[model samples]
Target: MCIRVGEIENMINQMRKSLISIAEETGLNSDDTICYSKKLDELITRYQRLKMNNKQKINQKLKIVTG
Candidate 1:
């Protein structure tokens, strides 16, 4: 299924929350938490870069239309 930018943003928000929740949990050792934390960071970074690239594309389109 195709995912929209809004969905990506929503996922980013959920991951942000999950990252915080994982940080707060006491029982999990660093070994377990490290994997989860890295995955969240990767997802968030990937989505953010995607969002930025999308913005750049839209701006280019606008410039083409206006020029």
Candidate 2:
């Protein structure tokens, strides 16, 4: 059940879109909605961090192989 980076990125994009729609419709009036939005933001931030880390790991591997 290995998923590719592209698939993971696509899933994140979908979640981002869904979150945006929810925010637009809800307007953050409810505490629950605001909390949910915060969670989504954190999720996206984590995904970005993971992606950056992965890129850095690959670069390190490439550097080792070349050097």
Best by lDDT: 1
lDDT by residue for model 2 (1-67), tens: 5555676677777777777777788775766567767776776676677788889999999999998
The global C-alpha lDDT for each of the candidates, from Candidate 1 onward, is 0.76, 0.75
How many clashing pairs does model 2 include? Answer: 0
For model 2, the superposed segments whose C-alpha errors exceed 4 Å read 1-26
- Poorest stretch of ten by lDDT in candidate 1: 26-35
Q: What RMSD, rounded to one decimal, does every model reach?
A: 2.5, 2.7
lDDT of 1 by residue, 22-46 (tens): 7678435665467677877887777
- lDDT (C-alpha) at residue 25 in model 2: 80
- How well does candidate 2 match the true structure in TM-score terms? 0.63
TM-score of each: 0.67, 0.63
Under the 3 Å rule for N, CA and C atoms, how many clashes does model 1 have?
0
